[model samples]
Target: MKTGRRLTSYALNYKKIILVALFLLTISVGTDLAGPFIAKNIIDQHILGIESVWNETTNGKSTAEYQGEFYKKEKNFSDNEEKGKEIRILQVGTKFVFMDEKLEFDGKRTFEQGILTVQKGDEKVNYNAKVLTNKELMAFYKLEIPGIIKLLIVYFGLLVISAIFQYGQKFLLQKSANRIIQKMREDVFGQIQRLPIQYFDNLPAGKVVARITNDTEAIRELYVTVLAQFFTSAIYITGIYAALFILDVKLAAICLLLLPILYGWIILYRKFASKYNRVIRSRNSDINATINESICGMSIIQAFRREKETETEFEKLNTEHFTYQNKLLSLNALTSHNLVGVLRNLVFVAFIWYFGGLSLNPASVISLGVLYAFVDYINRLFNPVQGIVNQLANLESALVAGERVFSLMDEQGEKVSTKRIERFCGNVTFDHVSFGYKEGEYVLNDINFEAKQGQTVALVGHTGSGKSSIMNLLFRFYDCQKGKIFIDGMDIINIPRQTVRNHMGIVLQDPYLFTGTIVSNVSLGDPSISREMVEKALKDVGVDRVFKNLENGYDEPVIEKGSTLSSGQRQLISFARALAFNPAILILDEATSSIDTETEAVIQEAMDVLKKGRTTFIIAHRLSTIRNADQILVLDRGKIVERGSHEELMLLKGKYYQMYELQKGNASLAG
Candidate 1:
């Protein structure tokens, strides 16, 4: 997967760490092997021996006639005593009892057989009898202190090495993952900023956020878990298998059989995981889209009482996400169950076969101790294999995430400007510029216009009549498909996008205010500008008094999008922001619509001061707002049908005059 490769590249720098981890892991496995080896030594030396012999004895005779008889009645004490004393309770292969010899009893009536009887007259003398019976073949026992000490040392050293390796691996892996996440976030955000406006026109902001945040996180998971685990697990499996083979070829053969079976299972699960994870990711994006819309339009929902409908839609998306998650989980469980079951049964079979073989060959000289150790090794052999198989699904998911992130990164950005424009003036022109969102349906058809320095041009058109499209063209948010737009007698197409945007100032209907002090928000227009300059601009916009009311006037904090302030206040701040830059040209996009009449009157003065000595384009619905323009162009269906002063259009009694009269009548009625 694309994302997988991208994330793996991050680990390239940590190759040395990975190698060290591998070395330490090998040492650890070797130390672990010593455990079974030590166990085998203890068993063979202490529990069994080749040169040992055993002798057993009986104190009474066996009653063959009594065995045929059931429990004949114990008629008297004498008969019972005789029966007990004559019967030999100890038999062949019976366990030996260890105690003092004084505890021995005679075969007759439980009388003491041999005891330290102190005779008064005859002094006690040492009397012994030597007797030989059956000698059974047995093993000798010996304990090695030096070997035990060596085993302990190995265990301690292994602990230290394993700890260091584990800690180091986590540290390096985390650092790598953080760096990759940072890069992914940067790239996704940067791409969004450079993408053309049309790309965002029909898309939801929340979906974009999901990609930048959630999708990128998914990709990060690949680096942190899937990518790293895949590498380490595979290496561990190989190393373990190699060690096992070197230790015992027969046992290793039994263990190696698990490899192909494990690989097949991984392959099967990966296919299903890829399909399900992709669906989960896509649906998560959709859910995010719904959430973004719901939150952003909360006011509208509240006003319309459509909360239930919105919640229903959200639940639908959530359900799909859950469905995808459950399906993937079920597949994962099935894969694990089958793989583990097979490995477990195979391991048991291997142990039985190996041990049975050793038992059958009495002269083979393979000790029971060795067989026990081999059995333990067989289990250890497949642990790393199982680890690799378990992480296979994670690897697949990471691959899917990687592919998505890479696909986004690989998408085409805005066309690059080869021919750079070095100089520019305020002379702007749209020469036969035509453009459309879709083919054969132009939003602006053969549009032509010009604005010289120190001229204010007013575009008067109904909604969708292409007034805003003209502004969009001037800003080069999109290039005109048909014709060229020029700035200062130079084609805008040749000028870099940054150069064009840097020279233009714009105020939209909904002014954006970032989370910061009021002064900072205004000063964002020119970060290098001083706080004093920002205050001066705010004063010029006649918002100085409002700032004075706050505890910290110029430093008054503004919430996101200026939610804490009124519409007029936000517009005034925006006006000051645009003025702070002192751009060569400015465009107002329905900037006065949200402001109240009283605030509009106040900002009108600020607008007048800011508009001087620069070319400006004004788009407004109120005729009174643009009556003072040097020229008014009325557009209809993307065509410029009328151009004149306000009075001149009124005298002609055309479309502009009719709209003006209607608006004037509505104003009078409302008043």
Candidate 2:
């Protein structure tokens, strides 16, 4: 699916809240857009209504007394009521003049010496006029005060309603946005768990962390800011255009030109912005990767005095990121506000030209109210236009971030099965097994081995001699490309990876610890393992003596990678963790290589007590460590060249014998 649709699908998960928000938004926009129309009504019907012809009336209400005659405005005269001869009240420039008789035509008006001259193009008419003092003019305006105040009250009420609804919509929209991002982050993190180990081998931890943190944050802005602004602008623009058409259709149609222009600019802006944004986001990820690598290997870098070189490398990535950001900034500067300003200017020019032409004709002249409302709407129209233009950058960024997030989600991952199986009898076999991490380059060739129930087997080899690879295959970390491996007579490939490894455990050379107490790390938060079980496992691994000096004992805190602990302490915790699971098959991959002699002896004693009734596979380089094993396999170049008990291999004087002798000589020389 496309990135947009996928993002929309996440939004749909909380559509109810969003729909409520949109409903509130519609009400808010409706109340807000009603302002100009109400002002137009007040202006035309009450404030400017004094210019209409007056009729003499006997009615007391809404009647103005002029020159001892009670007269009412034409609009105030009831239908079918008594009528009187009409007189006019007109404005001549800044002054109001009272005319007893209506003129033949009304246009440019000038009153002098009690006569009113009205001219339109080539025509002119004259009327007897009276100029009202400020006191008399006040009488005419006093009649409109109550009506104007009522309309003003209604206008203010609508504004309050608009504000309330506006607040409601914004709060609800932002809440739903936060919820959507929460669920998206959860899904992304959960997907990470389902991904295979090999997937992580190619990508840096910081890049993965960026996907979950930085990229998702950009997407959050998409829902909260970009989409919110777009929705509001869409509604606001639509409302404004509708009001414009109602005020004047021709002007509204002229405004329609802006739609295509704005759209075309967006298309053009995205063409360049998308390219720059992609590079920026990629370089951002690269920067994160570099920082992570530098932090992780800081010791080596500082020890070797490579800080200057590392700084240069990091600066290069930072510079590329900075360059693209500046490019995006330039594009935004050139387009967003400038495009809106230009469009605003163009619309205003058209508006002025159209209205100017209309003003030349007496019949085509619009009321002040209508003209005011039109200008108000034209100005309001540019607001949403500017809003949309400014948010284009965020829109593109969100789409780019969405693409990265979805691409990670799109990677093929194995479904983790929760199915459990009975423990294996610890008989493991590798039958004609051959495998390689990459195709066409075999790391293990025709490897055949059988480890029976309750037997201890040891694999001795140099680096890259397929020792760890065999254990990886056994744990189903990677399936062998050829031949079948079996555990207790069942093909391991036929079982789910989780189920296949249910009865297995491993202790690596460099043990990994999480940020928690040692007890939590050992139990791994499994409900099946109790505190007592954890303590017992720790005791069985001889961690009691090793960690006895610690304040918290088994509950002691272990930070990331157990960096605060000694290597021996970390390895012992790893051993306790494995024993807590009580796996039938255990593989210790050079578990004692990094520890001191005393710690090694403690682990060896722990192994002697823990290895009963279980098949143990030891990948060790120390020839003395596995001397008493039931079977020893000596490997070279991905093939087993010798196999037997240590003493039998020694009597044969073969490859295993040579390796043992070489190690003995090295030990003697060191002594």
Candidate 3:
């Protein structure tokens, strides 16, 4: 019922189309029933009462007989209703007349009296015919050619209207579905933008991709298929049943006996098949994530010689997907076969009842024409039954897809953007901060930091010593649990997220490049910044020579995340991107650690040029990198253990000096 309600809402938006279709279906069904009634009329009126004669001279003794013998042999009328009224013409010559007045035969001729009269040269026939029954009146209309033409016109009209409706539905369904899908994609992207950084840590990339791309697409297809197939099935079933009942009530009842069996099979299969399909969808998501991970880390996998192990892992997921898919297919096929078999059995039973009864008693009678029409009605019934079952299957799939799509649509993200704008300075401070991804086991505990405007504050720490956590708190990616972070003496929470981010620009150790011209990637997030500004930023980042070397310079296509460019070039482009924004505060989080000596020298020179006017926060392992920093803080665990200038830290011989000595020794050994 939930599924029905959801689907109904989508369909009700186009009520005009649905109503037209129903009207046409009604007309089509009526025309379809007219064929059987016509056959019955021809047998009773023309075949039975028909008598033809010929004059013959054989001997002195002559005999005259009616052609009623031929009618009896044809079994066109029942034999038990006594003989029809036979009138002999006394003239010498023989003549024949068709019963132009309609007649019904139960081995007797009957017709309407006082309405139709026959005369030969002003002498009327003496016989009075029986009155026409209501059934005979209806049968008469179908027997004639004009009535058949009327019904044919109705049938053809319905076929044309149905085809037009089908074409319109395809166009409208696709148009509406694409709009709905685009909106869903935007909603998912918006939600992820507002989510905390920890959300990404807990959720797999593959799962998110499945929800955004695959699940949303499934929901859209569900709407289209359900709209197309479900109504068609319903119309077919209704038309089939009505036609069967009109032909013979007893036969229709027998054919309908298979319905309960068909429905039971559907109910059973629908339950199991839905479950298996959901499993298959989940397994498919796992496979996609695995493939994405393997490709993204191809170098690491190859260096470790883990290709065989990765293949084994992928095979496991593939086999699971195969098993679930087969289960679904088997159940679907079983339900289809069961419904068809039951319907076939019912048809066979109806046929036997109809034929065997005719054979048993001479009084049990039906016209040859009507019997032939019933056979066609029996064939029509199967089509509607099959259509109904297939529609139900589509309905089930749509229901499942809608649930997943709505689930994503209903998710909530962090409340961050109530106010659009606020004022802020570059003075950043984190007071007694404590943070954790999970509820317990804090990664940063009781942290404290302050960076005044234009101050170069360097964080000297080992890996996992909470250097990045400080930057994360400063950027408001995750709020501190125990204390508060202030930007320009204002509570970070008071300002809009975008407002806070506007004051800071970050350069990560490993930067990403999009597939576009170099200028385009740099101009992102600040489209107002000019190409001239981008060029200046690149030159300031000491990558002007690299850009000049390229054939198209800033217009050179990066192609597949800047694969055409080296790692140093990629980093230089990212530096230019950050500089183009011209932020008040800059964060270089181990940004130069991955570069070679020559590229590092170029980056170091660029950094020296850009750091003059803006406040900078440097998180680095190389002591020489921050030797000229205005202040240095050494962190161990989550707390600051030492704070001084480079010479002061060395004089104190704390953890900073020890790490510096260790790295210096390694550098000498390499040299």
Candidate 4:
């Protein structure tokens, strides 16, 4: 799906609220656009109506008294009223003149010596006119006061209604935008969980963090600001065009030229802006990744005295990010206000030409009210135009961010299954198993092994000898490319990964702890594990002896990675966590390599007791640690070269015997 369509789908999730908001927006635009028309009515019908012809009348209402005669505007005269000779009241410059005889033609007027000369083209006519005093002019204007005041009240009322609806639409639109972003973040995070571990091996944690946070935030602005401006501008522009056409079709047709010009500019601007914005967003992700890597390896960098080098590397990424941002800024500066200003100027030029050459002629009947409304609507038209132009940058940014977000969502991921199964007796087997992280390259050769129920098997190997790889296959982190792995004689590949992992647990050489209390980390907030169960697991793993000095005991807070705790403390908590889950199969991957001797003894004692009815696989480099194993497999180059109990291997004087003797010599030399 297109990024725009995907974003629209998210919006549709809350279509009810969004549709209601759009309805309010339309009403708001309608009420606001009514202003110019109402002003036109006030100017033409009520204020300028006095200039029209008046007739002598006997009607008492709506009459202006002059020279002992009561006269009413021709428009105000009712049917069946007594009629008298028509007279005119016209403005000659700043002063009002009364003419008892109506002129044959009306044009540009000049008044002097009590005569008004009206000229149109080659025709000229004169009327004997009387200039009214301020008091007499007041009588003519007084008749319009009530009507003008009523229209003014209506105009203000419409403004109030417009404001109310405007506020409603903005509030509702923003609310729905927040809700959409909330759901999007949830989906993105859930997708991350469903993704395989290999995905994280390629993408840095910070880039993933940026996707969930920074990218989604940009999308939020898309819904709240960019779309809001676009919608409002669309409605406002449409309303203004309708009003313009009503006032004068010719001028409105001229104004229509702006639409295509604006559309073309948008297409052109996006062409350049999209390229710059993509680089900017990509660099932003790079900067995040760099910062995360720096923080995580700060100790290593400082210990090696590479701080200056690290700073230089980070500055390089930051400089690239800054350069692209400036480019985007320049693009915006060149286009936004400048484009709107140019368009505004062009429309105004057309406006002045239209009214100057065609509408302002003496023979033209176009009223001053129509001219005022036209200018008003033209000026109003640019507001929405400017709004749209200003928001173009945000629009592009949102689209790019949405594309990134949806791409992450598009990655192939396994569906997490919640189906539970009864715990099976641990009888794990690898039958002619072969696997590789990359295609056509086998990391583990065809391997065969069987670990019966409740048996403990120890794997001794150097790094890159496929020890951890074997455990990875068993846990279904990655499936074997050839052969099969089974538990209780059922092919593991046939089971859902989550369901298979349900009865398995592992502890790593470097244990990972979350940000929570020790008890919470042990139980992992699982409802099935009670506080008593957590305490019992901690006790079984000798965690209480190590953590007894702490103030909160098992409830003591553990910060990120358990950074505040000792390595031994973290490992013990990890052990407790595994014990709490009570997995049927447990793999300890070099679990004791980093521990001090005393802590190692504590873990060994706990392991001796805990290994009772569970199949345990231990990957170890310390030859002394697995001496009593029921079976010991010594692997080299992804193949098992030797296998037996420790004493049997010692008697054979083989590869295992050589490894044990080498470790013993190292220990004797250190002593």
**How well does each candidate superpose onto the true structure, as a TM-score?**
0.83, 0.98, 0.79, 0.98
* lDDT of candidates 1 onward, in order: 0.70, 0.91, 0.69, 0.91
**Clash count list over all predictions:** 4, 0, 1, 0
Query: Can you list the residue pairs that collide in candidate 2?
Result: none
**Count of backbone collisions within predicted model 3:** 1
Error of 2 at 256 (Å): 0.8
Higher TM-score: candidate 1 or 2?
2
Clashing pairs in 1: 3-402, 3-403, 49-139, 49-140
Error of 2 at 628 (Å): 1.9
Write model 1 residue lDDT over 1-671, tens digit each, in one string: 44545666755656676566556555555555566666676565434422112212122221112212311112222332433321122211233211112313211121123322322223332212222122311111112344456656776776677667666666676666777689778877888776788888877887788788877777677667765666566655676566567657877787777778877877778778889989888888788888888887999999999999999998988998899899988887776656787788878887788766765553444666777777776666556666676776677666776676666667668644444334345788889989887878899988888888878899998889999989988998887889999888889787778778776788898999999988889888465788788878888989964445778777888988999888888988988888777778889988888888878888787778777888888999988899889889899998898988888998999999999999999999999
* lDDT of candidate 1 at residue 25, scale 0 to 100: 50
lDDT of 3 by residue, 467-502 (tens): 998888788787777888887788987766667787
Off by over 4 Å in 3: 1-104, 107-154, 245-260, 351-378, 391-407, 415-423
lDDT per residue as tens, model 4, 1-671: 89999999999999999999999999999999999999999999888888888998774999999988888888777687777889889999999999988767667899999999988777788889999999998888999999999999999999999999999999999999999999999999999989988888889998999899999999999999999999999999999999988888888999999999999999999999899888888888988998999998988999999999999988998899899899989999999999989988988888888777874476667788998898899889999999999999999999999999999999999888998888969999999999999898898998889999888999998789999999999998898999999999999898999999899888999999999999999999999999999999889988766776898877889999999999999999998899999999999999999888888998999999999999999999998999878888888899988888989999999888888999999999999
Q: What is the lDDT of candidate 2?
A: 0.91
Off by over 4 Å in 2: none
Which candidate model has the greater lDDT, 1 or 2?
2
